[model samples]
Target: MRAHHDRAARALGVICEGGTEFWGWAGRTLGRAGTATDGRRVWLRMLTAREAKATGKLWDGNQTAEKAFGTLGGRRPELLAVHDAAETGVVYRAELSTRLDMPVVSPDPVLRSPLSLSPGWWGSLRTALSTVAGATTDRVAVRSAYVERALPEFVGAPAPETIEWVTVHGDLHWANLTQPRLRVLDWEGWGQGPRGYDQATLLAYSLLQPDTASCIRECFPELGTAATWAGEAVIVAELLQSVARGDNEELAPPLKAWAKQLRERARK
Candidate 1:
């Protein structure tokens, strides 16, 4: 696939045999992720013109996440390089870290351990969140106006101003995380956003299994606060948008129910 990007470029052919992951929403090939000739495995993400616009400050996000790699401990992949692709937008390639021995427990029904995670795992997650919250970044992930507008669409109420904003892994879900090892991936959307947004997103994605959701809530008690409720509302609004975009159809039902529950809570 990289060869298709530039037939004349010799380096493109050096990409070894791994499949590509496409993001249909962006309407572009994310990149051909595989091992290189030098035996280094990497994920090369390509952002098309439209996708660059949709993502906003695409390069800044990579830089921020790269900076975070130093502080986030061993829980995230190391950023290898970022290159300008001219009309095609930027290209970000990172070293693919070793995944956990246990598969991710969400989205996929692969054989895995119980939904409950160890207390040490929870501590590492909190440590990662705290590390990210303290990291500085100039990007605005989900804007205040966006949250306000989206909340009304799903919950029939404005988001509370009491919610505190912090740097977050904007796209936090089962797919972006690995278990047992507890490594986080896909740093394209890392930026400043509402506190507890990541936790809310993880919980929302786990709603299909009550036990998993309960475990997440137990691990992150902050999810019960008003701020996290607002964060959940934001996530529900995003998921509804995804549903409208013809994505996440399977999650639509649970997402709607969760949104309605949050709406009812807001009424009081």
Candidate 2:
């Protein structure tokens, strides 16, 4: 995959600096820090999969985000160029984007512990989220059927009727956020979702850090309100479903506890 990524860089006329290479889950994506021919720092990402399975929203997400958000006031890396080729029934797509100098807050998606984040960082994050939510798009992130089907079974809460949908980052976890400053990444899942879904995702991942969780709730007070319960319930169920799949098992305890609390709240 690294070889393919490097070759893709050469083909795109970008030079990959040899030190750091970032790999995504299950080897589906590889990203490297690089420079354009003009020495402008850039990030190059390569993805490969069977040609038959590579056509969909996930495949086109970054391009779609580039067109839809247009750099997002420097909150997101700008997608600059793309290179595509196919070989032996596999498709390889490479994307060159503006590289962020700041690193992600964590190596994992779930924040097992807390880190001190400045008030300014939180403010920037809120602004970025608000801007994203205000955008208009036909893309769907969380489907009602999934929420209706999974909520009762996974979260023990009846699904809320008439969920208000809003645009969201869709995968707003720790690894997708940068440190000392705020930048959101992994935009492949950004689209319309039930209100508070993004905040719920962040809060769910912060449960192990109780203070952090409280801070998130404080920052987005709407999260604990009845209006956002529909979205929050779905996010909790989604992560619990992940636990059932043998992923993020550590979140199981807090998630189950939180689900129980949500159920109690529903009863009230």
Best by TM-score: 2
Candidate 2 lDDT over 1-268, as tens digits, reads 7777878999989988888778898999999898999889999999988999887768888899999898888899999899998888999999999999998898888887668899988888899999999999888889888988999999998887688999988999999999888889988888899999999999998988889988898889898788788878988999999999999899999899989988987887
Clashing pairs in 2: none
Cα lDDT tens digits for candidate 1, 1-268: 3443332122333353445454524445454455545666655555445434543554456556777565268887666554444435544332233223454445442112346677788778888887888777777778888898898986667888677788888877776667777877667778878888888888777767777778788888987667677778888898888788997677788888888788777777
Off by over 4 Å in 2: none
How much is 118 displaced in model 2, in angstroms? 1.0
lDDT of 1: 0.66
Q: What is the lDDT of residue 39 in candidate 2?
A: 85
CA shift of 183, model 1, Å: 1.1
lDDT agreement with native, every candidate: 0.66, 0.89
